[model samples]
Target: MKDQIRSFILPGGNIAEIDTREVKACLQALMKREILIAGICAGVDVLDHAGILCDVKSTHFSDADLVTDKNVITARANAYVDFAVEVAKKLNLFASEADLQETINFWKHYQRVQ
Candidate 1:
């Protein structure tokens, strides 16, 4: 699973149902290997609580927002387009123009639905 994971995308919402210690440990380990860990909306709280955002500029669902930092990319809610693009870039998943366009199209449809 570790080798298979090029990045970890954390979604937002009330995360009280999550197992923080396990999540933190996993995130730390992934980050140690320089894996891209992205947090969107309240998901940034998990990264923050993990102490992984110590020296990293990050943002959650707040009025003010910071851009990317270290291997972490964060943004507020409703910024899924930026978040997804960042994740794709970090993981080097966009190999061709078609791939990139596909991602854009996906998000465009998603936005319309939302």
Candidate 2:
């Protein structure tokens, strides 16, 4: 499973710091190996701190602009629907537009229910 890791997903949070060497090292390794790294909300700050978003177009919590560069994709906290759909697309998990639309519709319904 470790050898086949295709992506690293960092959940959203109010992270105050991300300078820990170990965490940085892990991110560095992921980038070196071309593993997709995704950060939601404040997690995007972590990626930015790791220098992973140097040239990568990315978005974060409270900022709705979307960014897609290299193997990274980011979106604001409230845009999780878009974020999730983009992530699936990046991973080539959706077989067709219908499949992707279904996912989007599901999430839209979930949001409405909430």
Candidate 3:
């Protein structure tokens, strides 16, 4: 699974369920290998519990929808679309910059992706 995964995306949920020994261990392992880690809303708390946000800048329930620092990506709960777009950008999922803009227009601005 390590080699198969390019990034680890953590979704917001119950803090108790999200922040656990097993999850921390997994996150630590991924961190050691320098895998991109993304967390949204309460999920950012899990990353903090895992000690992944010590030197990294992050955002949670903030005015800014998305924030990326080094290998970490964070966002507020209401910024799921922005979070996804940033992740997609980091992963190079878009064929080109124009493709990315088209996606942003369609998904974020509710415009046609033309």
Please, what is the TM-score per model?
Answer: 0.77, 0.80, 0.88
> Candidate 3 versus the native: TM-score?
0.88
**Candidate number with the higher TM-score (1 or 3):** 3
Report the lDDT tens digits of candidate 1 across residue range 1-114. Answer: 689887887888997865379999999998899888888888888888887788777774336553687888998887877877877777778998798988888877865435
Candidate 2 wrongly placed segments (more than 4 Å): 16-19, 60-64, 109-114
Query: lDDT per model, in order?
Result: 0.80, 0.79, 0.88
TM-score ranking from best candidate downward: 3, 2, 1
- The better candidate by TM-score, 2 or 3, is 3
Q: In every candidate, how many clashes are there?
A: 0, 3, 0
Q: For candidate 1, what is the TM-score?
A: 0.77
For candidate 2, the 10 contiguous residues with the lowest summed lDDT are 60-69
What would you estimate as the lDDT of candidate 3? 0.88
Which residues of candidate 3, in runs, are more than 4 Å off? 60-63, 111-114
Candidate No. with top lDDT: 3
lDDT tens digits, residue span 55-93, model 3: 888884345778898999999898899899999999999
Give lDDT tens digits, candidate 2, residues 1-114. Answer: 657988887777866655467777798789989898988878887888888887677774224556667898877787787888888898999999999888888877865445
